[model samples]
Target: MADDIREMSFEQAIAELEQVVGQLDSGDVPLERSIDLYDRGAKLKAHCEVKLREAEEKVEQITLDAKGQPTGTRPAEGM
Candidate 1:
């Protein structure tokens, strides 16, 4: 259900998405079943994107000196 989807971690969502892709690609599912799987795939894809965007927003890049030592960290974007 939707509640279960929300609880899935990024890795879990991606794993399920991969399984869905494999099933869809196999072309062995009944039309109705395939439709259902496709819908779930869409939701999983959206969830994964949201997780990635959240991680991206929190990402920071380490500033290094000419000697290749990490000096500090700064936001990965919008600096």
Candidate 2:
């Protein structure tokens, strides 16, 4: 993955991935370009998965009080 891709937010990565999928599905890109797009799409998908995992971990960190109110976030487990 390029450094630029690593710096992209999840939304940006997902948008580009969707565009790449659309282009590949259309079957109009030349073979070389299709290969490049597929590679980029794979990287974008991985990045998105990592972002989602981070989000899920954060969600799991929410500390609840006796009344089930959110008190604060605890450290992510097994970090």
Candidate 3:
């Protein structure tokens, strides 16, 4: 399970986070288990946030034409 969590992609992380929330909401887990799940969920949330920010930065770096569309030029090539 630990290995799977470590290997989770951004979408998988978000899905697990959502499942954690559902578990917490159901009030089925013991207090200690709830806390542990919350901690893991927080970490997953942070990882997802970082991934989203990186994707946003990449989008911003893309040059758009006057019509607000990508010009298809690779921006990093010039760097």
Q: Choose the strongest candidate by TM-score.
A: 1
Residue range 1-79, candidate 3, lDDT tens digits: 3556667798999998999999999999999999999988888888888777767656535678999998765435422
Error of 2 at 35 (Å): 0.4
lDDT of 2 by residue, 1-79 (tens): 7898899999999999999999999999999999999999999999999998888677658799999999988777774
lDDT of each: 0.94, 0.91, 0.81
Model 2, backbone clash pairs (residues 3+ apart or across chains), number? 0
RMSD of each: 2.4, 2.9, 5.1
Residue pairs in candidate 2 whose N, alpha carbon or C atoms collide under 3 angstroms: none
| Model 1 weakest 10-residue run by lDDT | 70-79
Model 3, residue pairs in steric clash: none
User: Could you say which candidate leads in lDDT?
Assistant: 1
User: Per-residue lDDT of 1-79 in model 1, one digit per residue for the tens?
Assistant: 4778899999999999999999999999999999999999999999999999999888999999999999999889762
Candidate 1: lDDT of 9? 100
> lDDT value for candidate 2?
0.91
**TM-score, model 3 to reference:** 0.69
